[model samples]
Target: MVRCVVQSQWLIYSKHLPSISTAKRHSIQAFPLFAISGRGSSSHTLSADDNAKPLLMGPLDNVMPRHHITPKALFIPASSSSKEKILKILKSGLAQTIKAIPTVAGHVKAASNPIQEGSMCVTTPFGAVEDIFTAQDLTESHPEMDYDDLKRRHFPMEAVDSNVVYSLPDLMKAEKPVFLAQANFIRGGLVLGISLHHSFGDGTSLKTILQTWATCCRGESAAPTLTESTRRERLMSSETGASLDEFPEYATIPDNIAGYQPGVAKGEGPEIAPEPPQVDSHVFYLSAQRLKGLKDLASAKLEGSDWISTSDALSALLWRSITVARNLEPGDAATEDTRVLNIPLDGRRIMREDTNSYMGNMILFNNATTPLRNLLSSPPQLPEIARTIRQSISRIDEKYIKRAISAIGSVPDVSKVIMSGGTFGESALTISSWGNLHMDWGHVIGGPSERVRVSKIPFPGVCVILPASEPGNRSTEPNGVEVMIGLKSDDMARLMNDPFFASFAEWRCS
Candidate 1:
């Protein structure tokens, strides 16, 4: 007998159970409700005063898109664990996580006046847990395919449809939950999709939440403490009196640019081109051996005392390879065409105060520009290109970050400020690394996730560095790194065939 419990009500149903009422069974079938036990139960019911108070939003949060964070899919293979048990565990764990970070349960409230321009807050209401979580039984409708089959197919978009993930319209609604999740159970596995509001936090915060939830699911007492000192104002205080001139990453754009919309935030979605190109997505895996060789080759070119990181070498390779694939004429290199690499730098450790655990946006974009001739030189300048990239990263110190924040605060309207380093387009590339995040869910599901994937890429000329499947194993180094890239169809074809690129990056998809 399968006993499903919701709050104080118990609804029991199974293939062999015939004594249950038709109406009660129908209700269970319509909505498969699960109860959240532990601390979540006590805080599930909010008081009138709790609902009236609004959570604070930092300055960085305001500039972020008002939509949901990019959705991520975690694939768990089939096991003896029943669907009810998994949902119950996840629900309880999520509820406890929300109890620690209450801001996630709240909804964003847009600013109505100039004073509140970059200080929008989230308002929490009662009974929001139900709206934040959902479960769907897709065993009959969609059976799980082989893991290798799914990977070769690049994980179809339909796998993360509205049935298992929140739609953009639903997320844009002001009343929707700041954090949303759905669990789809198929014939042979489970697909878990989770999304948080961009205004609520960044990738680090999401990692903390997931880690804490997993701990709780394992029947342990684990709850993160979000203190007042960790708020955005602490790091981006306008009282510092820093000047915007010191920050060179951002510039003012004229209002006459076509398709430029006023008051709309950056990263709201993918930028729409006048004539959009045909884009294709692919994943490339670089084994540890290849990465070491690439790093050694690039390091040999560096002068004494000058060094580059693994990330730098990899980025340099991609930059050079991508430029070659663009198919620019050799004579065109004489022109002043330059390729730009936009890298997001995390400001947690650079700050004087310890904000490593702060669950808000602390990321700033740093652009590295290279002339077409230098990148297309006869012999590859991997080391020189890497040094340039390293220099751009090293320039971002605590002082520079603070000044950047102050510059942002001084603007009359943040929506008008544009990042000088282009976000999307063929000439620019944005590479974001999430390889250091903790996403192991073996404790809850009885095994590690087979694969983790971004549901969709928002634009072309973008690449994401995903974390290793077994990141927690300290005994041995990571097997390799997986890079997901989206580029023009023709450019992708050229990249795949390029001997230099094929030598390092192994294509993982069909």
Candidate 2:
């Protein structure tokens, strides 16, 4: 039976934890009336008093993103409004919609309860936005650089505005790159940048938030309602009093990843993205049926289990594709050392399905690969990649999520994670899918209602985000998952049309 815990808001707050440690730290351990098993079945009783410890942390603490790549360019075309009008709209919208810009940790440090400015968008007492823009970047030219190179680096929750301070309430928020100009009135070229935080939601969520602001600008009503649009929940349960015990006060992070290096030198960073013909967005399709077909084909050739998540399945496909494109032996990507495949896991599952709309970011978990030797030494096949990925994913239990929830505090400095993932490198590639583009921004903006649109900014060599135009209702579009992958000019040129990636018909038709 499909077992899901239903929680009350009080339990959520009461269960909020500051840290997660794998070492059983709690001095309490009492088995409840029901037994607990690894699988979700009624036969395996997960009673209220059992020692479940924590398979997952609070909602926000578990969904923090590992590969947060800023796109080389984020083009926001103010097609209808004057530049000045757009700038005013942006500032006012930002102020009204959020208390502050998001950061890697999902925290938005605000002043006292009654904001001194009385505006949701906070400004530093000295007249700067919260961690808005840095002192160095405020100068003219703001250091001309390449967009692709810096795409992988994490930005402080501060704004590109330069007047903000710092701190996280608990989680981060993923915000889209905003366009602001010196002369809000002038029709000169646009300048692009984003407030560093926003790992809490998917790219589509950010786009919807921006479109929500656009609607606010027009004094129009937003569709789906904010309460309905943004849902949230904490994964840990104190239900029936909870069978799992409290977390160990000081649990250590799993260092099981053989060559897992936390921080790496920024060899190159992404600068600016190219201006597009128009701000074109559409829902791409990746069907469940197609996925099933592929899985069947792979299963015939390779003996692997059918119980696998869609993400693990697709990632295996992409990994196989990349290795093929590179023509490296599966072992080749591995040095005499281990090779890592950085996978980003969403945190929506951690939250209660009934909850909605949050101001900060959530915790993100990654299923990193084992050493190169292991991957290379094993049987070679695309499905095998899937199997390995499945194995890796299996290790990302609630304990690891708990550790990640506490990772923000571990930021040695700069309020960033120490992990050095290849988000901006040409070799790094990411794939993501939003189950279904269930909401529509056009409807909110008072336009003809239609499918929604979203993006995953390109950084991790090749970035992909999938959002279904319809949830399980396949008639709208089966396997209609929007995949948005960004590649530097050459990389895109090489792999854009390869068999591994095909633009969704929804995207093409739109």
Best by lDDT: 1
Model 1 CA deviation exceeding 4 Å by range: 1-51, 114-119, 144-172, 227-230, 238-245, 252-276, 423-425, 435-438, 442-444, 469-477
Runs of candidate 2 with Cα error greater than 4 angstroms are 1-289, 298-306, 328-338, 351-356, 370-380, 410-416, 422-427, 434-438, 441-460, 469-479, 487-510
lDDT against the true structure, per candidate, is 0.61, 0.33
TM-score quality measure for candidate 2? 0.46
Per-residue error for 80 in candidate 2, Å, reads 15
Considering every candidate listed, which one attains the maximal TM-score?
A: 1
What TM-score does candidate 1 get on C-alpha atoms? 0.81
Judged by whole-model lDDT over C-alpha atoms, candidate 1 comes out at: 0.61
Per-residue lDDT of 1-510 in model 2, one digit per residue for the tens?
001100100000011122332342222223211111112221122233322111111223222322232321222212454444545554554444432222211222211332111101111221223323211121235333222222222111111222211111212332222211121111222323333223234444454455554455555554433422322222223223321122211222233333323453211112122332222212235666766655654455444444556666666655554434433444455364543455555444443332223323332434355444443433435566667777765766644544434332222221112223322122333344433323222221222222322222213233354444333455664544444444344444444354444521223321
- lDDT tens readout by residue for model 1, 409-479: 66555544434443223466677777344345554465556666765553456777765643345467656
Give per-residue lDDT, candidate 1, residue 398: 69
